[model samples]
Target: MVEAAQQPKRRKRIAMVHPKFPPSFWSFGFIKEIGGFKTVMPPLGLATLAALTPDEYDVVIVDENVEDIDFEINADLIVLSSMAIQEERMFEVADEFRRRGYFVCMGGPICNVLPGRCRPHCDVLFEGEGEYTWKQFLTEWEKGEHADNYVQEEKVDLRDTPPPRIDLLQTSAYRVGCIQTTRGCPFNCEFCDIIVTYGRKVRAKPIENVIKELQAWADAGVDFVTIADDNLVGDRVYAKKMLKAVGDWNRARRYPLAFYVEMSVDAARDVEFLELIRHANVVETFLGIESPRSEQLKETKKFQNAATPLLDAVKIIQSYGVVIAAGMIVGFDNDDVGIFEDQYTFLQMAGIPIAMLGILQAIPRTPLYERIEKAGRLRSAAQGNNTLSVTNIEPLKMTYEELVTGYRNLFVRSYTLDAIGERWLNNVKQWGSKRDVPPFPGKKPEDPNPADEPNRKWIQKPLGRPRIHLIFATLLILKYYFAGGKEKRNFALKMMWGTLKLQPAAFMQTMNYLAYFIHLREYAEKVVARDEKFNYVFDDKNLTAESLGEDGHINMVKNERSKKTKINVNDAYDGAEVTADIAADLEAVQAR
Candidate 1:
């Protein structure tokens, strides 16, 4: 190759990274002043793998979970992308960018489930799904032919992917911008791997490629964008012709960006595609509703959420004003020990302020890892360690210390402070006439990076049904200034200055549910108390499958069954579960 094209073109840079969950996997507090009124997310698949890289390759993205990855910025190639609760900080950022000689390159879904255990600190591992292995590793690194490992180009042609360089991000550490109209999830749910990583046939990205990505995120001033779909109605006539072509492309651009997606609560039987995603503003949605229990939804095959009743399909999709966010789970296999007070009284009677309950992890070529390694139930030292605090399956009934002490008493009774002031007063009274806004959707707040927002603080707007001493005065001064002491911070600063000197809308909805319950009570007491716990107790005769280290070689070889049963709770409150089919059956039991 003519001395590889006259010998001197190695200036390729790249950085990309993006991990950092501690704050208990961001249950709420992702800093920057509690994720500035929420909607952070931007790492859109490593900024769409740095926009299929190769503009003579320079890239720099670094989101160490929202900001601070500039390990002195200089780079020749680092590229990351995590998730397996971010493989121990992506193997300590690929061994500190390969001891700073720099040449890392890994990929996500925990390097597509173990790229040879990140080939001894990766020099390249781009496993599956990175829009054609990032343009064939940037056309084999502009033909110098770079390589160490790149075995997966699993694109599945998401409508010929592109458009995500989102102007090479950094755009003020995100407030919103993440797009995907759809891709995989037809429902097999055996502890999901999203159909073994985006399969079960359901891909989409048309409707003018999602209105030219909502007119390039309303010309990059982005108001909001997350349709990062696991299911934005997986093909219901192309999700109602892409929600009536995003409600006629935001009624011909008069509706500037604002959406959030993830579906299946049978998308409330498409009331005109939930009123065209509520006239394309799409306030919020996360759904999943894991188990309202139909025999734990046919023991996790999740038969399309057992033909819906998840609190009457989340109060008929929050009676079309949107906002619902839920996803619950805590060990499965016919769950009993009063399934954490029936999922904390079904998310405190389903007003679902934001559930995402966790714990039943297994992941790794799912079908619940080949039927819990063919019913041995798995865990012999959790084979091929894919860290999410090490859960490698096996719990057909209980004892992984009573399913991690009933997943820390289902997050100490679903984040109590009176269950976040009764699910923020039943989602501010069932989305109170859908956050009213009879007009304002045309785009006035186009403030992109307002000089990194000087002294920001907004949230007032609620205007009704808020009183109970301004809802416990900013959650009793953040439960006494984040529960440390100095006489409980002078009795929580004299009752949070006597409720901001007398009820400032319950001291701003208890300082917005105290920044999401101080990150869900420190991720329910530290990274879900380091997760993994299987022990079904079937004796692995004289133990030592090399006493399995890397994280329980398949739930300690499926807990060797020496006789572990113990699950017998009867009438914790009489098989409690509620549902009716639409628009406020008490707001789907207050979004449980």
Candidate 2:
């Protein structure tokens, strides 16, 4: 059993909650890859907060998205970090702990925007970046001068930020832990709230400081790390410097960790930037191809990504050898029925192995929110209460139901078992055909690991499968030998068979996604049910315009429906008058 200190030391207990992940059907190679959900890392914000907290405080990190918080552990303080999607559950947690006499404090993106909304449940509602604000709150709390609310000093530079307390993390639970090189994006996409939270001017930690953190992780024996920048390549000059710093550091250490990052399609313009990324041992980059249509892109003011040939761009990025995971949205104002088929065909043509098809929703404090409101399209500004199809504006071309149904159809068709199988089959075939392409120029051959050499024999190594390769090779040669011009079919079949032999585990994972498809069908039906409910109370003429106030957000509302139900004219009737009614009923029964 764990021990508690005498006098309790007024020990502060903190619990950090991560936002629920949106459903991802195509993320992990279309199957339950072995290190699949290992991508779910500890919350870096809370970890940094812990690093900043006083050493006297007892910090117990609970990542609710991955593990349960132990309520049985008696605590004097409970701190929570959350985002918009998790505000409801975060409130529930706060309420439960408050009832148990614990001081609950809240912070992160959701609380930062709507402090007054979360003020009721929390003792300290910390708005803005938690690095400085959290320390201030703790100092006051320790001195017994705690307030009902605490807002962080705005525009705190992130360069001097402390490294997160990695000792608090469950290292084995992830393929990699997260580290941020920069905060904020340069682009002003209307739908994005990143700039609102982090500001448009990007703040990057110094390359030396970033290297120190990576070195610390490597010393701790962590093998995988994600540079969790909202936009890693937003500024190519900084990206080059940072990527080179990481690559140089890793090269000295003989390349210890594999990295992943998120960036825009504009990174394609910088060839040197791409080379640095490749040299850095970056495995994957998530590209936001929000929509394929130029009109939709312009409507959303995602002009940085507009007018580009998506298939050609994807192929160009792929030729650099880094895997691409594209993000696609379907509920833009210009979207129509044809978009469903267009998106599917686009993915197929681009050779994109994974695409995230999502519905558009109005996020808080975004330019989109202001613009939509001005257009008299604010659906409900109830903030955290918004769910699927809670966008303020009507989808201009398609009805709400049509949009919802179209999204469902797109997801269904794109993630179908047969489609997934065929995609994998095609991906393997394409990659295999290009296997003869020479290794990337200027990339150093991976040096051997000295420490690994000692323990190498004890570690299970791959069994030689030369015979299997020969057998498959012979069959392929014969198939191509026989098939005249339809060698493409023969090649596809051979690759499918080779993929099964070479990566049996990955192949099985692809097959397992068939089960996820079944679950998706059930989930889609629930979304349909919710959409049907919306149809009942919809105001066709104004759509969201009728519900919102002049300021263009439903910040407040009167509960007239509840007040009306509580009062009744029939309540004044006396019991003696009611007795005559009962007597009539008895007489009727007697006659019967």
Candidate 3:
């Protein structure tokens, strides 16, 4: 063994790689076409980790989303950061780097929540917040300890946390910048891992610190940002103050910034909060309106959403001119196959055009995982991209095969061109015509990056975003109309006439929704096609799996569902799922 005093004094080189995300709806794959950006939101956690890294080290960030990883780059150690969705690629990179005799360190949400799976792949693993643990590791590394793991025993304090190394980012490559103003969430939804990783108690950065980060992003030419909080309204009092400060700051700027945020649906009840959001130039809000049905809502312990009539709550927020992008899920104990049509109808009525419709998943470290594991009901590991109907937990009410069929149908029915167009145009009419509509969230107003921004002249306009470069608009209109068949021309005409007739300012937003159609429809089709290999079809009109009873013609899968087995939604301790009763449900499925 080498002596500790014999270590080289030379500056260490660290290669920090942010893993590539799998194809998912949330990735906004359409950004590359219209915005010329590689991704929507940048990886905030990795960037923050780089800040925690010591000054003497030469840290180079390689975001796989913007550019491919250069394995030959100079480095003494390799650091990989990833979310649960990026775990597969994270491990592959880790194992490769280790094979080449490099010490690989892994952290971020993937490692924090699923350390067991990640531990074997990485030489050094970090769990929970890296703020304190990373510094501890750095101290030990300099002393040549070569420790295998470092974990933060206690939650981090945001006040003392250093600003992320934003200077290290290749900022221009991303369409929407991201900054986390808070850590942790208040609610305890059983299947969710947000509270699992960050915990239920919320921690927030100071207002001044947030503005400092905003100004840093502004300097880097990013004016449109997404507040990457698990739930921004987790602490209503703190959120209100931060919103006011941000709104004031944005309004004072030469070119105001636009923002998007995620919060619980109950935020609609707080008109003061909505006012703050509007003044803050927040153009969009993603609400976890997981299900339209009250039973499903209560079942997940997502009490905030269950407290309100979802459709009315969605409309209340939209009336403030902030468009709502919703999260919808299927396969609850209370859910039968009929949730497909139920959710689709609810989304249309609520005019929530953008949705991340996914199936219920038992993520690692969550209550769902423990219960399902105990019941011997887990089918496969959850890869964290729920959009493709992948889930580890077999539901208490439906067979895995039948669940997948309804899931596939939900995507097709929800994303059908006609369905999306109707919702899109209707939403534009409701909010777009009121002149209260927020500016289209995009690049900085004055100077958008030419190479990355598509149709720059049209999208960079200040305030209401009323001006569209007619020449460029004409080209896009012609390209869509004549490029394909009947649907193409109709959508093309709809894009042009819809925006122009309803609200001129809504042109960019109109184009955005149209691009979503181009992406979501094809994506849905591909996911459905991949699932077709199992050879099962369930009628979209069927109310439940039993309704297709002994039908030789309608339902291909004869998976039985049990009404007898269910865990009390209130039994969800804190934020963890308590689905011990689901064993009976799965046993019933096995019997069929």
Candidate 4:
């Protein structure tokens, strides 16, 4: 531990920055556009950290996704939290702060896993859960005895976790507010780093504490809340208690809050639990159906997923009126050439329209990374965007090129106009037919009442209708009708008719899916184009070089040598061109 020197005691101005995320399938910007928000979600981690800060400290949060970072702001210390995708920008921001003589501290998953990469840029580094360590650091800082590195040796008690200072957020900027009820997952998937970071033992906040946080959001008039847990039902007993509390809390309010969560497939096994989740008004659940192939599940040690048939489990959940957004991965050791077709077929068969497909990545600190490193198959650090046609490890059965091509092909086939429409229709049909019993005392307004006769006027009025969402839905339906062929036009017409007729309450959900498809279709094409352009870089047989042609264009040479490679600079390669600055940098590298 490197301690800081004693200084005069005073109130500190802390600027916490949540780094910008690169646009990906998860960004969900289209949903934000339709839903009337700038970003898909706000920075919950930063908000929680701000809540942990002492009241004496003047704190300001800057989420780069929502607003510009004011570099000129006067601050005694700067703090940053980020994931792997934002690592490059985090380092850049940290270095900028350091250059300005600001005491910068960094934490979160990226800094924890790749400390060496972040250490040079930050004055203080925090590794692991900061619920306790952050307070300790602040105490030490006030005493002028803060350490350069503060790593938490013990897991945090979730009961002690404070409600996030959500007041610091610009609520209108985000489509959804976030609240975490639990931490860690029970399963030990070889490729997962959640256990490495948060540990395998599930720790949940008290039901009252969770409800208190939700009440804060409710008081703030935020309707959509994402329960940002790895698996909310990791402890079934605790989950039931939490769900019941949330359901009761939601029922008391005029505008009930809708929730979205991530959970394992095993949650579907318990019929009573499913009813509770439905009553809680959870709109969607992201399930990690990593692969349909059972062999791959066993090989990866994701045995919990294989406990039940994957398709049947998905159907069971959808049967409870919950939208299932699943994750699927290719390039597993047990996967072969046929895995692509198998995955595509399985998704369609399962009726999971919003399938996030990706090539398997060996994240650092995970068992998969260790195994791959031991096998000398590790190529590079994970890029963090799993949907990209890239991986850090050399696959076992397939070459790098094969994996990239196959993964890209899967995206194209899976997200095409026809495929998405077909899957959406199937999903809606299944969802509409589900007999979701309201676990609460009062029936949902959307649920048909047996005691009262159904009136046409009551049915015509859309339940919980947002005018903007309706407008977007109408436009999307028109786009589908005019732009598509007979089959697509018919599908669009059917969807529009079915949603309004059978499940008017689910109209928003239907629009959300269409919005996602619109973004995904475009993004998938971009991924394909990106892969084609960079495929040569990953080609082992090809020798690549950057050469400046006489036309002043940067030419990427592969396999064959170019005559224009020779230049006046001594540091230049035999057949490559180099500017004076680049030549000097190359000469310096040679000297080292």
Candidate 5:
């Protein structure tokens, strides 16, 4: 017999699609009108995968949140990356492509967390971190054969990672760019899945590696970037070094880049840490002050937050001219119906402008999940996007009705025009004057609890291009005020003039909050009007992944208004529904 010949190497075309993210507070969609951008940040994971792929492969990345995907694109492989919240859209897209006979490969957090639900939807599946596993798959792909599943048993070393393909992103569609400097958080917040997925040991990319990414983003016309780490200050020593390197890198540029980061509330404790952050030109810090009540902090084992008063921590970070945003939670086991009022009062008192308040969820395989399951309170799988105001676990202290009702009202109250004006005013008024302030702040007589004292580390940074900065700020205020109703215009005058008078340096943040005033309030109104009928997804007994229907869609039922069904153990219903899905069904009916 003649010797068989080896298959020739071929450069395959790959299409990477990120599913559309459902509307939530994080959508920040008002930027479309305010800044003419549709998305907040690009999908960095898919971009990183593009960089890791061999150069011979043709790659194109599409973010559904920014633009629609071309269903019929010419591609040898259809690659998808999604979070669990985006599974429905991911499934719809995956099924459509597979129907057309393309090899659909799926990966990212969606696969890692829900393998059983996802495996059947794609021809090839990848679980765990893609940095190493992705490269392994590509090698076999080049040989014309690869396994159906690729799982990474070991975590990736940050120093070995390459810069993401930022050049492949549609930079003009996003208001801010994003990069990850670290993975893994040291805290063991019971409800958190980040630690479960990435582990407790913090791993940071080398300072030089981060600089390469920063330059890539800057070169791609990205001026404001978000450090999308779960906790940037997880390792303070590495964090300080990273911040200073960024500061030096930024200083060398004619136009410096700005950043927003998520960090532990305790980062405010170290004066040196805050200085380095300001040195790096960070404009904001998102602190996970999960609850205002100490009991809830103890309940979740979030000891770091309990180490200091959270309200004072807010004040300390704010003094550096850094905006304070927060991650807040309601529906902890320690919470009661009264918890709603308490959360509202605490937010108002702390002067934090952007609080991402969510009803706490019990994520799978976490300590909280195990505890909830053991206690028979883990009702269903988590929907993953926490700020949506619905969660999987049933409340111990309040009824389901009360939980959703209170959450809806809290959303409305938190973003009201009056509340918006007060918080921003408080934000600037509390900023400590740099030179005259004493070392120990918040002291009638030298109090050391950081949040109790005003920070004395305030420094004025140069206005790089004053005309451009002033015009952007002016346009924001004018546009928002004109677009808003009578109540908003009144609040804008008070907030804009008050911020300029109290601290001209804080004017930009004040105008930015006005955009939030429109975006968040509109989101709240849409959610509140949502027929609470969708909340019935939880009331179904023995409801599992199968209950969401064979297509993984909570497909809507076309029942008369009088025939609206409440979930029951023996209902035999095969599908669940979300409010958006219900609205789509309504549109279909009207079209018919």
Candidate 6:
């Protein structure tokens, strides 16, 4: 470990930049506008990298989504981390920094998958988890010896990881804080690249370390947090112990923090686990129920989802007071024309208010990518936005046109005002009705041997000083209540009434959902319009290996029907001027 007081012979200045992200379903700019924040969440990975840097180096972190980068600051090195969707902008940023004679270093998931494309722009590239590789790079650099690439052949144990440098962030810029509890998933879904990146063995931090981090956040006055785990409860025993510790920690402080997480659908089967999460004050979770058809699940090797009836499992989880945001994908090899309707009906029947519908894309090096590549059905590299009504692989049972059309229709129908309102009402009602049970029954409420309380308070009154965004959200909801048609007006009233009667916290959460719908509905419409302009055809009966290119991409030609349509980002809401600049900024990045 590097000591904080150590000083190198030569002091170095480093600038860490997080590249811009594209507009997508989860951009949540609309919600950010109403919630008085700039981004949905801070780039925790970049923050962690900043913490890993040697203490002698002066580091400054900049996230382009929150603020513009200052090019005037002189720095010895520039470091970047990004996803695949931000590849173009990332390259542009790297070129700009390299032009100014700064040594550029790049790493993250994108670099791991596409190192060949990323190598030319960087002086050094750190590929796998950086807990160990980063330290090695710093040591070598200080001695004037640096390599073009440093990849970790072995995964680092989670126990040795340090707390992320949250002090580097402008805390008020994001709506919620982020923390990662676990590293990998045990399941082998064909299209998933998680195991390829982090291995199949689940690695987690010790419970004491987790609590110490949470206590740090609590001291910093962070009220809402998002756990950025691939699967929070992949190992049931570890999860139970962690949740029990968290529950005890929260109860002692009067429960100030609320959390959100991502987990597999199998969590629904564990009623005891559900109650534990509820007691820990987890407000929501996202589950990857990729498809409703058993055959499709089998083809993708998502056996956990295939083993159970989908709707029953959803209801079972909601019965314990946690809202579910489901992920649905179409265009699998086994999906036919009817799969679209099946997906829509399943979400409606299951009362999932927030369903992320997408066409499947085979990421590079995953089992699905290898299978499709060998079958000569690959089309192109994934654009990293799976919900964009486009697929990168040729389907076996359906044409590309059929798949795009079905995906477009599903997105449009699912996010309509009436459709979303109905689902939200049902979900809020179900969540409100669930009884809050103690995770540890028959245990005394008092702590037997109380330790000294941290010299900080956790809870902050939300209604004390109303933010501008909250006021805007209120006006919009009221406008829909009074000016909308009878059905919308009635639905709005019932939502407010139910939330007030059951859980007051849910009213704000529901408002946030409505804000999200404003963005997603508009994006869906744009995708549908974009799809309508594409002209293509496929012949299933006469398909041949010659149709695919040497690089495993399919060759398709567009007809005269192809015409680009300009998309307006401000068409979804009535009072959208507050967030108009956000849309303009994203459009400018997209153009670059």
Best prediction by lDDT: 5
Q: What is the C-alpha RMSD of each candidate to the true structure, in Å?
A: 22.2, 19.6, 10.3, 14.7, 12.4, 12.0
For model 5, residues 1-592, the per-residue Cα lDDT tens digits are 9989989877689999998876667887654556556777799999999989889899999899888988889899999998866777898999999998999999988787667778888998998888888888888877978899998768889887788998888887887788999999999999888887788999989888899888887777666789999998888899999998887677556325778899999887799888777667777788899887778888999988866656556767876767788998999998887777667766776678888888888766689989998999877657656665467888988887667667766767777778777777777765644311212111122233322334433323312223465477458657767676788788888998997788765555566667666777776666432523223221224433212223322212222321443222111111212234323422332232
Residues 277-393 of candidate 6 have per-residue lDDT tens digits of 866767678999988777888889999888866656776676565678999999898888777666765676566888988889888778888899899987755656677655668
Once fitted onto the true fold, the runs of candidate 2 whose alpha carbons sit more than 4 angstroms away are 1-39, 219-221, 381-392, 421-495, 498-592
Q: Over the stretch 1-592, how does candidate 4's per-residue lDDT look in tens digits?
A: 8799888767779999998877678886544554456777778888899998989999999998899887777898899998877776787888887887888999998876777777887989999988888999989887999999988878899877899999999877777778998998889999998999888899999888898898887667677789999988888889988887787677666324778899999887887788777657776789998987777888999888866656567767876767788999998987766677667666765568788998888877789989988999877656567776667778878777666666766777887776776566556555543442222122245434311212211111111225566576557646755586786566566666767665565554565566566667767765443542333221123322212233322112221122323222342212223334434533443332
Candidate 1 ranges with C-alpha deviation above 4 Å: 1-47, 50-52, 55-106, 117-124, 127-145, 149-215, 219-224, 227-255, 261-282, 285-322, 332-336, 348-350, 353-359, 362-391, 394-428, 437-592
Candidates 1 and 4 compared by lDDT, better number:
4
Quote the positional error of residue 5 for candidate 5 in Å: 16
Which pairs clash inside model 6? none
Q: For model 4, what is the alpha-carbon lDDT of residue 330?
A: 94
Using lDDT as the measure, name the better of candidate 5 and candidate 6: 5
Ranking by TM-score: 3, 5, 4, 6, 2, 1
lDDT of each: 0.60, 0.59, 0.71, 0.71, 0.72, 0.71
lDDT of 5: 0.72
What lDDT does candidate 3 reach at residue 192?
89
Model 6 CA deviation exceeding 4 Å by range: 1-10, 436-469, 476-491, 497-506, 527-592
Tell me the TM-score of model 1.
0.31
User: Pairs clashing in candidate 4?
Assistant: 565-575, 565-576
lDDT of 1 by residue, 331-417 (tens): 788885667666766676666767777767666567776777788877643322221333456676776656655555566556545
